[model samples]
Target: MDRTTDIIIIKSIDQLPSVDEIKSISRERALKLVFKENINRQREEIGQYLDDTLSGFLVLIHKIDPELNIVKLITDKEIEDHQNFFEQCAKDYRQLGQKLVFMLVDKLDLNLNKDFPLDTFNELKRDERQIGKVAEWKYFVHGFHCGFQNIITGQYIEVPLVFGLEFGDLDPYFFVKFILSSPDYHPLPIPLFEEYADGLRIIEKMVSLGKFEKIHSKIGGHDGTVVTDREKVEIKSNLDLEKIFVNHIKEIEKKSKFNLWKFLGLKK
Candidate 1:
């Protein structure tokens, strides 16, 4: 059988059989699911709670080898008592000598009575701390992952609204375009590519001075794959761009004993 075929997809609670049922599932079967399908090391998991109810659950079981295990539970709005159900699952899995590595597949929707100034744009203004002193930066961007979903047309559709963050004010658009332009895939649309290039130029101009600002892009995807969408770009009072570039070259030299151009068979 194909290796992926041995992996199971659990869509509902009824499929669980019982805590005893999972225990009966061999270690080899369990290991295949966790390593092959579930834990996405790229993006941080986002949880969603509905009207005081948990809507879904995706857990990877790694307490075994030869196979990985995954348990996925999804429910409609009717399941109001999901917390208790999840607690029971935890208890059951504990008995089976397995722990749950939770994953969320949907965005959280919080119902607040008033519209407080909690937006990212607003928070940036209210927080008066200096950019470099903040220590941490949040970069948010959205993009698609092909084959993550299936549409009505029976084609594996792309997941387009994926969003994520990373440390520092990295421009995510540039990072994504760079990755896509690699030998693995084609480049983004011409217009979008130009927009990203222009944004980078503006950032370069700003970096000449001590002031560093965030560049927002609607088409960019986050998850550190795109580093350019950093919430805070370091603004050193005595910034030296040339020195930084030289330092980067030295760092690259440490990793690569020979020049990159020479490695690519290009004449220096």
Candidate 2:
């Protein structure tokens, strides 16, 4: 297929592409998306639902209502090469519905490849690729240390390093070891401390969002903090800590007696 051709087009969740519109597109372009290694009746069934005359390409339309999230596509073969594509599509659709917003295709595919090359998404040239049109086109490569910072200065920091964002999904131990072992890079003494801090930020954000009461309970507490009976019960109950943390932060901010800087060990 010609890279110049706009094979797949992304529309707002509110707007849907009809099966006839998809069928009108060239067959080869459609087939590239839907074809699979092994033919499955399920694919055909989905195709039938989208369009009766699915000659060259099979059309799959998955609509998640309430959020009005929709993914409409035509492929010549089944999606057998990689499972990540379908999973990402589903996740994107779900997120659209939940957030009631549009997000870049890259964010949707964060979990698509556990090991996709970092430069796979980096564009070699401008105008070579359409941003939101192409389905499988590379978009952006997320940096390795997305939120890294210097501890003493509390300033955002970036090491002279570049890693494929795909490693973000794999087990952290392997990635951490790889970074530490690299002869070119001198890793911080307390690498795990940074990871823990990042995790804590996520937990604190969750608490602020009112998603759960106690995140430490679910993750077995922070540092060596013991899980009390109440925390254990909350963990067993699977409570959300996001909102709790949000409220807690608000309360702390309002209290003049509390000193968060000291609590964070940043104050002298």
Candidate 3:
């Protein structure tokens, strides 16, 4: 499943912990302090109120300025003492993410719910067999897979039957072109991509002076066959994902103008 939300509180230089604090303490501590200081208390309940996919989940503060700090929630005695503090940290960040999503929605000028980039399942119309097999996958993409469950049920249709192309034949070039297709043929609105890019620019400004690590996805790319082990790459936009997908979607608008004609059965 292509899912995951990376929530961040972009802190200014002065707003961030002092150099001494960052140097002296663990990342978890620094992040908690950042939350304690910066998060707006009024937005604390936004997570429950929204009650979407991103809610009830902890989006760890993956990175700060000078270094990468992917704070993990440990389940030991040491963590138990600070559990309340850490819970609030997660809540604050979740609310912060919820607020930013709404702000992005407002910027898009779309009447979308609080879940701006709603992660919808394989929601198809009409007949069930019309869709083929439905696969639901939940796995890690940040560093490595720690736990996972990927299941596919129902009549699975061969790729050639659906897209008139072999699954193995699908490559980056083709996928990129397809995703980058004209807005007229695209499933998602092109404006959403534009607004996402705009929001990233704003985040870039917010953490200009602080340690801003390029968003990196734990997931790697496939070159038709093998799933290669990968390093953390610069994935801007919240997830290495948003930045990457946003860039890909935006590029589709720029380079694939002929898609509209093709979709209309016109020679392109």
Top lDDT model = 2
- Provide the overall lDDT of each model, using Cα atoms, as 2-decimal numbers: 0.28, 0.30, 0.29
| RMSD in order of candidates | 24.3, 20.8, 21.1
Put down candidate 1 lDDT per residue, 1-268, tens digits, no spaces.
Answer: 1112244333432432344444344322321232223433311221111111221223332343423333222222212223233223222322211110000111222221111111222223334311111112112222222111112222111121222121223243432243233332222221122225433443343333323333332333222122222333322211343354467678877897677688799987
What TM-score would every model get versus the actual structure? Answer: 0.15, 0.16, 0.20
**Which lDDT tens digits does candidate 2 get at residues 155-240?**
22121112212111211232233334333334332222223322333233333433323222232232111111121311221134
Q: Candidate 3 lDDT, tens digit per residue, 1-268? A: 1222233453433454343443343323313323333443422333223223222123233233222222222223333343343233223323332343333335334443111122211111223322222124222111110111224321111111111011111222222232233232335322112222322332233224221222222334311210111222222223544564577678878986557787989986
Cα deviation of 128, candidate 2, in Å = 32
Clashing pairs in 3: 65-211, 141-218, 142-218, 180-252, 215-235, 235-240, 236-243
The reply for model 1, stretches above 4 Å from the true place, is 1-193, 213-268
Cα lDDT, model 2, residue 61: 45
Candidate 1, position 225, lDDT: 21
